[model samples]
Target chain A: MAQLSYRDAVARGIAQEMRRDERVVVVGEDIAGAGGVFKTTVGLLDEFGPKRVLDTPISEQAILGAAMGAAMTGLRPVAEIMFSDFFAVCWDIVVNQIAKTRYMTDGQVSLPLVIKTGNGGGLRFGAQHSQSIENWAMAVPGLKVVTPSTAEDVVGLMAAAIRDEDPVIFCEHKGLYASKGEVPDGEIVDSLGTAKIRRPGRDATILALGMMVPRALAAAEDLATRGIDAEVIDVRSLVPLDTRTILGSVARTGRLFTVEENPQLLGWGAEIASIVADEAFWDLDGPVQRITTPHIPLPSADSLEDLVMPSAESVASTVEKALQS
Target chain B: MKLPLSEHRYGEHGVVLPPERSDANDALDVDLDRRRQLYRSMREMRTFEKRAYDLFMKQLVKGTSHLSLGMEAIAAGFGAAMREDDYTFATYRGHAHTLARGVPMTPVLAELLGRANGLMGGKGGSMHLTSVEHGMMGSYAIIGAHLTIANGAAWSAQYRGSGQVAVCFFGDGTTNIGAFHEALNYAAVYRLPVVFVCENNLYMEYTSIHDITAVPHPAADRAPAYGLESIVIDGNDADEVHLAAVTALDRARSGQGPSLVEALTYRHGGHSRADPGKYRPSEEVEAWKAYDPLTVYRERLVRLGVSEDELDAIDASVLALVDAATEGAIAGELPSPESAFTDVWADGGWSWRN
Candidate 1:
């Protein structure tokens, strides 16, 4: 095991995959000589050379389209979109081409490509840069959405995303880039569609993703002090959702509170809440609560951004209200 | 409508076809067998498309189908020039392109019919036909989208030292899209081995290209901007298209970077089955019909010592093949409802139902 930051873990995962397979390539803007904007792809160019680590023009449509094409051929491409907000620019390539290619081709081709983009609203990057758009990815059918919370999970999940045959959108939170945690030194591949129980409890189950995972964990700790045992579940994969784990936790706790950094209306949290309500409605002791950002663009001011986003206090308060009901 | 004596034409719009070399006489040095094969492929595509048009008119084929009635020469030429392993990508009007790439006629016909035996298992209809085994990468419905994808394929070939080139076929309208420029820029910068073939069929759907685009020569005029070598070919002449494709593919394979080939042609049919092409001028249509690729090629073949009976026999054979394929595809079974859930993911664990 080794202590690594989330960014470093991502770089290590990509590096390891590239080392193992010559067909694996990394392509993005400024990912070559300058490392990535977030330094997530640092040292890749020097290690893999220019052939594998290609620095492309500032065209998301071209980058994604090329990556899809390469994936169609024989290359396992890992493309970075700089920020998840820019996915809108390449929306056609992702939704129309990438998502539909496999199903449209009837299993004739497999797109073993990873689209790594920074997501979430923290660090005051303003409206354009700081939107957590995991909901958009989850809404797409063919795409596998992975949002790892910790450095260790990033390592495992990134490895798995690189190996997945389907196109995987790895939504790395910009807030979690600097966060440090222990990651396994060797090969670690986590299975997609599995949720990890961070803090096991019985009072209420808290399902969180990306940055919300740490906040949920903190809220669970705070709830423990108040004589309430809150179970915290980190939802790593959003598409092939680990519904079994969430349902089992909800059955044990009899209460559910889903948390995410995205907007409240039609967010990924709502999908989880609806699933729990439909599958385990009778088992729920109270109505499912969702703690998410307000349906407004994230502002540049830190205070306003904080107000819009969910915090540990907010998660704890939501849990308290659910328990009181 | 008569064949020009000079073998070169420079229009006021900057469209230029270079004069034929004196060293090359009668069919650009292509052997008789290859010429016969090209003629057969073009005839097959033409017959198949006409039959498909009738099927569409009868409401037998589901959804809208785009027919390349006047653009078979480009597909046949590129298909003949490209090696079996080289990848090919095209726009929605890609039935001829796919057929010329050597994909079996049954699956393509079945796909248009939306049967279980279709190329994409009835999932991808006429617009999205793809056969990876034959290097027919995909036929994208979206304009200019597949150019960058083709660049990626070229990059893969370059990276793996696979000695393979990727050919992207699009229309003049596609050249105006942002992806077209982006793809060309990247292909030039990376020196990727890709050939961008523009089938300038004078119209983009119901609208004329002149009304939409400011540039007269879309491919040639734009090639220099992206640092690409450009050529203009007589699209109606299969021999000219084949020679141009060979030159471009050779430059790509030799690591000379990407090039653009603008094949000036016209679509005899409408953009899709729903379109009647009432917007087209009657005189323009008549003028183009006189230069129909099949008719022109047939006359050239007869002049090149191929008997009239032999050409008729070839046409009959092509008609028979298309008939067999159509009958088999129409008789094929419909896909099970359960199959709609399959092939979405490779792992096979997740289903659309969940």
Candidate 2:
């Protein structure tokens, strides 16, 4: 195993897929010659050449439309939307066309494509650039949504997403781009709809997604020192949620807490909280708690941004107070 | 919110129209068999649409359907010009384009009735017709979106050295949509094999396209900005459309990049079954109806040395085909309840759980 940054893992994963399947191609703004604006797709243009790696203009609809059309005809295209916030510019392509085409065509056509975007806040990119809009994609019926917190999951999940028959929204967090983690050397393809039990415990269950996974783990470490054992679960894929892992953890701890970076209203955690309330009602020792950014646009100030998003300290305090009471 | 209407935007001559190319077929070069095929395609489309109108009157048609009542020549012309492997992406008023791809009338009609034997097993309804086997890629209901999607198909063809062109057909109003311009610029930049066909049928639903649009010819006028040739043709004449389609198709197939063609025609009927088009003046309707594509094409066939007896035979056969298809479509049963739960995912199940 070698330690790789989360951004480098994205390039590694795409290179693996492109080398394996000739049909795989990448299209986005500055993704080809420039190696992507975030530098997540470096070394791809040199390895795969311009034929496999393409750079397009700032037309989100064109980028996605070309990707959708290519997928329908026969080419596995991995397109980028720059920032998750820019999905609004071409939501018609995402929400109405790409997401609905397979089912609307009644399975005659399948789109095996991936739309990777820089998602979430804390980098001070302000409101337009940094919103955790996984909930937006999750609301659509025919889309697969996943966000990886670690480099290993990034390489593995991107492979799984590109190989899947459906369209996947791969939300790569900008906040975790510089973070490092160990990734297996050869091809590593993980499964979708499966959650990883980051930290196993017995007192209470903590569920987190994307960048929140690492924070939740840190929160678990913080709570352990306070004598409150916490089980931290990484909710990797949202559409095909691993209820087996979540429900099993809930049953063991009899208490649930969701740590989310998304805004409060209709956050992904809201859905999990609802699910736990319905299925694990008898298993609960207290009310299900959701620690999330309040329903407001992300601000650019470091202190203000930190105040809005759920942190390791906030999660620790929330879980401790709930478990102790 | 209400906006003031200019005096130039109100009467029989409210919309500025393209000049008629009355001699569009002066030097047209189509052989005997090809002419018959074009005539037959337009006839089949006309019959299918009339049958759909009848079914709607009977309350048997499932949902809102847009028809190509007088726009058959555009579909027939491009469909004829396109190679068998070439892709077609059309708008919601796509029954003609779908039929032009040689998809049989029975399943197409059945799909309109929401029947089990329908093309999509009654899931897509009248708007979203798609047959991947025949290369009728999809019929998008939303305006301007498919133009961008068509670029992808063309881009894929270019990448794989398939030598296939994607012919995307949409109404004139689609030019104003944000995606239309983006798609044009994208296709030209990559030199992808795509042809954008705008069926300028004078109206954008109820509003006159010319009044709302900055330019008289919405699509062709925008071509220079994208470095494509601006082309406008007589859509009522199959010969004119076929010749133009061939030029554009050849341009795209040979990697000369994309071409934009605006076909000038008039909708004889309203936009959909729900509209009677009382908004259009009777004189204007009558004047336009005189240039009916099928009638004019049949007359043109006689002038081109094809006898009336041969034309009559083709017409009789088309009527019989439509009659049989209507009967077959009516005989199909409602889709099973279990079908609703299927096809939501590639696994043929709608499970979102682990």
Candidate 3:
């Protein structure tokens, strides 16, 4: 085992998949020689050569369209969008074409492709660069959306995504890239849709994803010291959500608090809250709570950004509120 | 991944066929045979579309379809020009193209009727028919989306030295799409083995090409700006279309580079099942119908000694085939809703893991 950052884990996963299958290729703007804007694809071109690691033009539609064709014909492609906010430029392909091809083709074709992009807004990147659109991804039916909070989950889930015979949106939070953690060697890891329990507790359940997972874990630890005994569940995958795990945890705790970086209105937290209410309503002692980002564009000022995103203290307070309610 | 053949020719003879302006009067015996085959294919497509419309009126089919009634010659022209192994990417109006490529009328009609035996196993209705066995990559419903896909296939073919060309079929309206420009630029820069065929039918729904694009004559003209070889042909004439497609295919296969062939044509039918084309002038429709591909080919065949009786027999036979396919489609079963979960992935095992 070795210490690794989220960015490094994503790189390792891509490198491993490339090594395993010659058909696996990486394409994005400046990902080859420039190592990607976030350096997630650092040293990939040199290791895999130009053919396996291509530097594509800044046309997202062309990039996605090419991946669709490549996937249909047999290549397993991992396309990187510099930022998740840029998905607007290629929505037609993603929503209308890529998401519908499998069902439309009646299983004749499988889009064995993975699209990777960095999201979230804690870095004061402003509205365009800082927006967290995880809900948009979750809304699509055919795509499998995975959000890994730790360096280890990043490597594990990304590897599974590349190997899975379906289109996957492997989203990374820009705020978590440099956060370090222990990463085990070898390809052995957890499956895609299974949520991991970060901490076992009985007072209440705190469910979170991506950057929010760390905050939830920290909140759980802090709550434990105060006798709250909050259980922290890291939702690694969103689309094929681990509902069973969440529902079971909610059943045990009799309370739930979901955290996310996106705004409170239609954030993925709303989906989780609704699921718990509809399926495990009787199991809850009080109404479920959600600690989420402010329902406004991510401000450019660093101080304002700090105020907008939910921190560990905020999540802990929400869990305490849920427990007391 | 070398292609099955490096260079293909008409028979064993090494005679060079005329380029855009093929020897009009000095045609070879093989050329005559090729033209006859082209006529037959176009006739079949024309008959198929007409019958499909009739079926739709009778409420035998569900959903809507984009027909290729007036553009039969373009399908015949391109289909005859390509080799069996060459791939084709078509748009929503792709029935004529698929029929000409040898997808039986039965599955296509079955698809329109929402039957499980349809070409896409009834999954893809009219707009999304795919026949992998016939080298029909699939018809994309998105306007110009397939252009980039075709470019990628061409790039792969070129990279592997396959000598095989992938032909992408789109419409005049697609040239306005960013995908078209980006795809053409890539094809030009890489010199990929791909032929971009624009069946410029003039109208994208109610909007005309002249209203949307600055250069409307041959969308192929835009190709030359990207350093690709471009040609404009009479899409209503099967002979002209076949010659243009043959030349483009030859250039692409020989590693000369990519070519754009714009076949100027018109759709006699509405855009889809419900489009009555009230947006356009009646005079305009009447004017285009004068240049109907079927009439032009029929006149050509009659002049060439294929008597009226023989032509009637061909029409009757095609109509009979269409009727039988429609009846079979009506009798066929709808896909089990359970099949909805079926092709979501390549294997049932993969879905289970998720």
lDDT of 3 at B156: 61
Off by over 4 Å in 2: B1-13, B16-26
For lDDT, the strongest prediction is 2
Per-residue lDDT of B1-354 in model 1, one digit per residue for the tens? 112323654444433333332323364778888899889999989999999998887787989899999889999988999999999998888899999889989999999999999999899999998999999999999888899899989998998899899999999889888999999999999999999999988787788776678777777779889877557777878888888899899999999989888888888978888888887776667667777888888877877899999999999999999999999899999987877887779865346233
- What TM-score, to 2 decimals, does candidate 3 have? 0.92
Tell me which residue pairs clash in candidate 3.
Answer: none
Task: Tell me the deviation in Å of residue B171 in model 1.
Answer: 0.9
Q: What's the best-to-worst order under lDDT?
A: 2, 1, 3
- lDDT against the true structure, per candidate, is 0.88, 0.90, 0.81
Q: What is the DockQ of candidate 1?
A: 0.66
> DockQ of all candidates, in order?
0.66, 0.85, 0.50
Q: For model 2, how does the per-residue alpha-carbon lDDT over B1-354 read when each residue is reduced to its tens digit?
A: 001111112334664332332444745788878989999999999989999999998999967999999899999999999999999999999999999999999999999999998989998989999998899999999999999999999999999999999999999889998999999999999999999999988889888887789986789889889988777777878888898899998989998999989888888888887899988777667766877888888887887788999989998999999999999999999999999888777898888876
Candidate 2, lDDT over the whole model: 0.90
Q: What TM-score, over all chains together, does every model reach?
A: 0.96, 0.97, 0.92
Q: How well is candidate 3 docked (DockQ)?
A: 0.50
lDDT per residue for candidate 3 within A222-284, as digits (tens), equals 888888998899988887788999999999999888888888788888988988888899999
Worst 10 residues of 3 chain B by lDDT: B1-10
